[model samples]
Target: MTTAYWCVLIAIFLPYLATGAAKFFGAGYGPQANSDPRAFLAGLQGWRRRANNAQQNAFEVTPAFAAAVLIAHQVGVAEQLLLDQLAVAFVVSRLLYFVCYLADWGPLRSLVWAFGMAMIVALFVVSA
Candidate 1:
């Protein structure tokens, strides 16, 4: 498979990784863990809350990214190298976004999020 295809695979699971990290960081495991997962998440603070927010953000961006990839492929975009590079940029930006969110780097996280969105937009633009 192409690197772009592999990027799509990684994108598919990225949100789950964030969600798992949120749960782990929020202390949602072990014998004393709360039975209500929703309550557990709702009570999170600081970095844990940021992790959950990142998880939600990941979910929010995923469909757009996936659609861009699929549409770009179907429309036969001639710039394979550009498509691959943008795909990689999107994935890397997302990973950095997650880190920035968890680390509470508000401005940097916003910049990373914008970068990821830009990558997706570039995919569609290049394909068109």
Candidate 2:
């Protein structure tokens, strides 16, 4: 499989990392919390809340990125190296975006989000 394809897998799993953070990284989490993870997650505040939001955002964005990569491969884009690099860059942007969200860096998080979206658009464009 191509590096971009692997990136698609990474993109798929990334949100779980954020959700894990939401469930484990902050106060009040325990084995009992796992019994009602949804409620536990909803009750989170501050950075924990942000982690949940980031997880949601990652889920929202992943499909677009994955579809773009699949479409790129389907159309047989000649610029394989470029596509892989863009995919990697998107993943990096996502990681940074997660951090920015958790740290409450609204401006930088938005910027990184836009960058990842641009990468998705570019993936489609390159495939075309």
Candidate 3:
């Protein structure tokens, strides 16, 4: 219902998108297609790995967002700037992170990862 919620939802989806794209283009590097679920899943392992990254990112950000929201609500800081910024940071960092992960960007990926965590911390601090 809120921007933060939407950001989390987008975060939840990005990895799946990245994974699907990887599977689509990963023809030569994977298993032969077959009716077997195991074979089909094997063909999409690269996509699954990317999806794992997305899952991890979701796991990292969701708790922070929920905690920030609850803290803001309890502390009467519901309209705080940090909450909004957290959403922005979560979205931007996630987008960059997915790009970096998929494109094999090295150190820059770590920087984006740090930025996202810092944003979550900032939100927590402001809410507290």
Best by TM-score: 2
Clash pairs for candidate 2:
none
What are the clashing pairs of model 1?
A: none
User: Backbone clashes per model, in order?
Assistant: 0, 0, 0
TM-score per model over all chains: 0.91, 0.96, 0.67
Relative to the unseen true structure, what is the Cα RMSD of model 2?
0.9
Best model number under lDDT: 2
lDDT value, candidate 2, whole model = 0.94
Off by over 4 Å in 2: none
Candidates 2 and 3 compared by TM-score, better number: 2
Error of 3 at 16 (Å): 1.6
lDDT of 3: 0.64
Give per-residue CA lDDT, model 2, range 63-114, as digits (tens): 9999999999999999899999999999999999999999999999999999
Residue-level lDDT tens digits of model 3 in 86-112? 777777887888778766676888899
